[model samples]
Target: MDLASQIYERKSCRNYLDEEIDLDIIKDFISKCRPLNENINYYYEILTKDEVSVRTPWSAPYYLALYSEEKENYFENIGFVFQQVSLFLQSIGIGSCWVGMASPKKKKSNFVILIAFGKSEKMTRDRSSFKRKDLSKISDYEDERLVPAQLAPSAINSQPWFFKHSKDGFDVYQKKQNILKRQVFKNWNPIDMGIALAHLYVENEETFDFEIKNDFEELKGHTYTGSIKI
Candidate 1:
């Protein structure tokens, strides 16, 4: 199975087994992950159970800790880049989860987020099982191209993304949050938007073009993230 195909079947795995994967092979795959923004410098560290604390339904054998240089859209850059790792894991019969409620025991200035992954029993699911917003809810109009983003996972199921059609393509935005929701998701929201974009790129690897837009029309309740053509 390919990463693009796994998008429909992939879920936040909560049934990890006590097993180890070949670290060498995993490192190689991570080295080749598509970078939505290559200009942002980033690296990964494989940590064991001893290195971090996780509050989740399942425990993982290893956590892939992402560290990136801070810059505009860096959070989204990490989200866009590492999501491919999650999808790739599922394609190879491993399971993974994005653990926002996790922290490293020895936190560094650049540490961004954790991707908890490990061995699991291979599972199968279909589109009917997806819990997501309707196509119309995510965009001004229904678009088949936006299906991948519709099903993309966000922290606590926030699904904080919106799309607007453009003359050439479309623009992406992070949906604005209220005061209460903002407090809970201020940091995670940009990262979540990146994950949504990753789905579009993974499915359309050949022609995924992402660029910052300065002259974009302002959305009433959303922050412009980027422009996309795919």
Candidate 2:
């Protein structure tokens, strides 16, 4: 399936069949995987159920742990890379979910995120089934390009992103976090931006150009993440 199709069809799968994915297939997928930022150093480790510690009561037969060296845009890079993997899993009939609350028992590196994946009956969902903000609510102007972004997933479904479009491209920003939610989402929100960018790429890969702009003035209540020039 195409990325756009995967974007519309994919759903978070928490329950899995009692089966283990073939290591060769996982390795093959990893070999083809490319991080959005190639300068960042990262690695992936496949952990069995016994090796993971989940804060909640969810269970999965396998967990994919992403570890990266601390650097600029590390979490965002992980989100971009893993989002691609998530879509790929959906295309290949595997079920996956971004498990932010789960962690490895032993810290090998800076653990960014965990993805739970395996064979599951609950895999895909119709496009109408996705509960997301409308394009107008997420972007400053109406542009069909932002549809996939509006559907991008985030921590607790916070959807902490906003976009302003211009002739040059779109300027991306993170919504201001209130005092109560700041502590929990400060680090996670950037990753959410990366996820949104991944969706944008899936929707417009041929023309999208992602650029980080430090000189752009921050909006009154939002934090600027980057810009996408098409």
Model 1 alpha-carbon drift over 4 Å, by segment:
none
Model 1 agreement with the true structure over 1-230: per-residue lDDT tens digits: 47899889887877778876888878888898878888889998999978998886567888999999999899999999889888888888888888888878897889889998888775457889989999999999999999999989898999999999998888998899999999989989999999999999999999899999879999999999999999
lDDT string for model 2 (62-121, tens) is 889988888777887888878887888888888988887889998775778888989999
Could you say which candidate leads in TM-score? 1
Provide the lowest-lDDT 10-residue window in model 1: 118-127
Q: Number of clashing residue pairs in every model?
A: 0, 0
Best by lDDT: 1
Report lDDT (CA) for all predictions. Answer: 0.89, 0.83
Worst 10 residues of 2 by lDDT: 26-35
TM-score of each: 0.96, 0.94
For residue 210, what is the lDDT in candidate 1? 94
